[model samples]
Target: MEWKTTSALSNQAIRTVGRIVEGSHDITIFSNTRAHPLSAQVAGIDIGRRTLTLRVFCPAGNIGDYLSDGLVSFDLEKINRDDPPLLLCFEKVQATCERIHSSLFEVRCTLADTLLITIKPGGVRVPFVLGMSASVSLDVYTGLTISARLCNLSVGGCMLEVPLEDSMPLTIHQQLPNIYIQFPNGEGLRSKGSIRNMRPFGRARHVAVGIRFIDLDRDMRQRLLYFITESEAELARRMGMENRRAGISPLFLVSPHDKKPANSNKRRNKLPPMAHAIKEVARQQHIILHCLKNERPFPEDMLYDSADTLLHLAESDRHQFLYALRYLSEEAAWVRHSVRVAALLGDVLPTQPGLVDDAREAVAGILLHAMGKPLLLSEHLPSLDTHLTASQRNLLKHHVEALRRQLHKVGWSPGPVLNRIVGDINERLDGSGYPAGKRAEALSELVRTASIIKIVDTLTHARNGRPALSPLDAYRWVYGNDGYDKKCLTRYVRRYGLYPVGSLVKYTGGFLAWVMELDREGSPRQVRVVKNLAFQDSKLDTVLADQDIQQIGKLEEVVDPANFQL
Candidate 1:
């Protein structure tokens, strides 16, 4: 529907508004252009147009970041008692602004395009910016009340531009252990709340804090309503009275570091088309991993598209695509594993120069080679070592087939050779490997590429959930394994050293570093020091400058972090 010209609010919109006023619920804004959600509260409702004016929040983006963005395209979300659910998504949202206080801006939102409606009740939202006179007490129940002035207020919550006078330990999501809000009329309201967001109000000046009120009792609600409605006129006058002060509305509270003109264009983040498509695939891949880890039902279409994205990426720009995958959700253990295996293959392929041109397809196959294992429950998995359980052995044999099904579900085939490689990682020369235990002559030469992945997989997941083995121990375990190709393993060790890239190692001074590369002698020529046993608690996650490396001589043992005492 054309939200701008629509004369009346839809019944669903009207109900959402009523709920906002009844208890002052909160709303969340999902802006396409912004990385963070704009938490807001409802300021007023239009019963006639089914439209609501929102007071955008400034809790994180520094009051400067919020105002300069001047409203982004976003879908507004809230929850109500309905069968399907309520969601009001807009193609674009426009805004007009006015200064409500020295640190707060009062803005109203309008739809830039027709609204898109969907039935999916998930989260609630409301917009509120404050220009009011109130004494705020936080954590009141604990006898520690923070004296703060209100900058913006909504029925569901309020934004306080707190001065840096008292450096109380404030953190996001920290509960207002207790609150007592004192109004101008000697009326008061006490409520429970938690920090929704916080941002710098200005450089070395004050901070903006967003507090979402919880469990508003009838008495507290009435007092809040009375103060909001009764003082509306004075608030408007205050906003309108001073021309010079009002002139600063567009000044946008800026940071000390970023001093730019108001009209300066926004920083661009739109990726190139090819990069954009790869990004989408990487994003979906991360989500798919999350679903698999949590055992949620994986969407067939999303999975299929993600596969297509990975395959499309293989044609060119493969390095860029791999880099994007490396940065996915820092905690993505599986993504890290995939990159390690890909890098291992990258190191080995040089030994076999003939495979260099086909490296892209090789990398693609290696990435998805082990994709089938994660799809099974732990109870159904077989032990890879000596005491193999029946289920474990069975899983090992058909794991390639399982991967094949996943590829089919995405309507993707990893090319003929790549398809075989994905399933053939388990097949060995001596016919000991399961599923299709083709003898050496029967196995295609492509098995050499998958061998590198197999070797690295053991190192990456040495002890499973336990601390991984040292680089030396990991190499020893897989070096003479019958299934692996000896030449590939030898080349890998020579290039990456016993400790390969991404391996954590200890040094002569009890410090820990991740080995980045090796010199001619295979000593760690470069390392990123992550733990300093000497200082114990100095700086961490740092790289030793090349000039400083000469000062530290010799190397220590390769130790598992779980056994290391810091």
Candidate 2:
């Protein structure tokens, strides 16, 4: 989003704490500190065959302390200070001198053995256990019954050394009934488990498979804590496992839904004001883009959170308003570019009555637009090859039909504007667009708007690398005769201007400052002169937003290299 400057303020630090205040647009000064620094503390202990050493450090405290001992336990005393204090604890122990049983060490598996496993239906890989801890539920598909032991497990999928009968096909609806595993203490984590996987082991006598809890409710998850804790303790006892010692890698577990409360002890973390919410929406949009690339379905709760945040931001901060639009576009690849294109195509609406609703529907459409990609290798998205056969294009066109079918199953019914936005984000008014070559009159204004945003988003990524197109350059590109709808484009350009406020720019007069707010004449005012004449000076050192653009008209005409000189 763009900001305008009127120059009444100086050297102001804008800290966006979105989760602190909901709906209200308010900024309060907490301290006059030039820069606010947050701190993190970390501690580590290393255990070798014969000894152990411990150390702790605090960035905020500027303290480095160490203590060492043999098989001794201690507690960390909480330190209170003016600045927020963080605690990080870590430990490492060597394996050479550990008193581990050779039998336990030789938990072996042979070739031709099929291991039983279970997981969420249609999930790709099992969770990787070697990294951070994760919970998985294992269930029986037909009976719809769940195992208490396998219900929610913290272990990486166990290895089974038993051979499976030909009766098990390892298909989507099939299960392998028997698998066994022995923990370090000779206790069985899972014995005679069924169907997570049953593929024959390559050359070894064991088939390594994955299992997830099928009915792991909150209570069940809580119960699994004891198992996890005990497993960690047992592993550590035998292998001298300590912090930094990697766990067994498990297969990736796909959760049934997404969006949990923010993982923290603190509850009631109030939502941030409109401006802050807008930034977060943008951040989540990027995260969505990442999730889609990996074929991971968007989490339901995250979608709602972002949607709510956008609705609030659209009330004010129109310049940043398109961020919500961008969020939707990322969901549907065809419409993925539509929101930015729409925002670039028209002015911020005087009213945003159903903008959020429109955005939500559009996201669903965009997400399904490329569903056929995975069905056909050539069209599988993120496809970058220059050459393609006619068959591949035909295969790609089936995505919309596939999209409709899938959405119907999920009870999604998009309105007309949304339908067009998703359908024609790839279309052109000149009848040169793809998917459908419909012209301007045939498309809804909302759809047209989405298209323009899509184009801008494409251009943003294409032309801009470390440095993006200047506001003027962006406008020039979009407003040209061959560009998007001119009337719509002009309205958008005027409001956002060549360079919106808050952005750092270098003027023709060679002054460096942040654009503060716009004036009646649509000119930028300086917020702070980070440097003047390419060098820092006493006058350019502090924040200055109290000055008006009329006082610095010449400097207002300049545009710095987008991201550079900022």
In candidate 2, what are the lDDT values of residues 198-296, reduced to their tens digit?
Answer: 322221111223443343456544544445545443323223234333543122222447444233222112322433344344444433332332233
Task: Go through the candidates in order and give the clash count of each.
Answer: 21, 68
Q: TM-scores for all candidates?
A: 0.48, 0.43
Error of 1 at 42 (Å): 24
Runs of candidate 2 exceeding 4 Å displacement: 1-276, 279-308, 317-347, 351-411, 461-467, 501-504, 508-516, 526-542, 546-566
Q: What does candidate 1's lDDT look like per residue over 120-145, in tens digits?
A: 23211212212235567775323344
Worst 10 residues of 1 by lDDT: 260-269
Clash number for model 2? 68
Q: Flag regions of model 1 displaced more than 4 Å.
A: 1-284, 287-330, 377-397, 465-467, 545-547, 561-566
